[model samples]
Target: MNSIQMDSDPIAVLMQEHHRAAKQLSLLEQAVISINVDGFTRHAFECIAEAIRFFEGEFRQHDKKEEQFLFPLLEKHQPGITREYRNEHRELWSAFNHLLSCVNDVEDGRLRGSSRQELVETATRIVHLLRAHIANENTILFVKAKKLFSTEEYKEFRDNVASVTA
Candidate 1:
């Protein structure tokens, strides 16, 4: 932990956003399992698309900044802990991207020729990965970042979150 006392580290705030994203992701995943997308159910597709877009729009920015700026700072402060966080972030992002790509294929009709099982698998994998990732960040990384960073740091992070939510 850096001796610096930031009001709230941006990482902690971003971690909170991840928790919210995880719940929404779960709803979309449930819809995927329960609904028939290959039947071209427009409403179901729209719901899933909206959720995916929400993640792409909100989560992407948070991750980018965390990976690019906040993460590096934390790594400098605590190499071992930051390494674990960074790895988890990368894995979660990869799974999310992979899952979203499958959804995009279905939306574009490319996945129409495939088994519905593929789509189901994609949804399951994404939901599982995101939930686990959020749990780890919320329980471990967020607390660490909050304790390690100072108030000014927290303010900056909050501003970033506000900009995205707005």
Candidate 2:
């Protein structure tokens, strides 16, 4: 069975979410690495469809939290580093959209053979980019931003995110 680690720290919890998303993305990569999207049916189709839905829906909302809540908090506190941080987030956002498009292509019967290869490559690139983004955000950005927010500020963010996502 699959189990997740429990962490009460708000930032830690969000980082864990990132880890879970990355794991799901990795599973999709492995799924595609060994099969053709159009060729796979039955169980494989279900699995890939679930993965795509999670990435397309859940992860997209998660990105909203970063863009609306987290990044703004960090940018307010650390103007000097905002450029690099925003740049990375922007690129990752674009890559995620591209990955979504590739999955859409597969779902719509446009992906076959080498087209499947392109889809897999696009997904893999998103996974790599997000993994890197999560690492940096957890190690540096989140930690620093936590310092900037008062307990009140942090609590506001925490409550709003939980309410929307729940």
Candidate closest to the true structure, highest TM-score: 2
lDDT of 1 by residue, 52-137 (tens): 78777877877776666666555656777767667777776676777677777776767555636666676777777777777777
Per-residue lDDT of model 2, residues 52-163, tens digit only:
7886777777777776777776666766665676687778678767766766776787866676667667667777777787788878878777778777667766765676
For candidate 1, the per-residue lDDT at 118 reads 66
- Point out where model 2 deviates above 4 Å: 1-8, 36-44, 111-113
The TM-score obtained by model 1 is 0.73
Q: What are the lDDT figures for the candidates, one per model?
A: 0.68, 0.69
Model 2 local distance difference test score: 0.69
The number of clashing residue pairs in model 2 is 0
Cα error, candidate 1, residue 125 (Å): 0.8
Task: Give the CA lDDT, 0 to 100, for residue 145 in model 2.
Answer: 70
lDDT of 1 at 73: 51
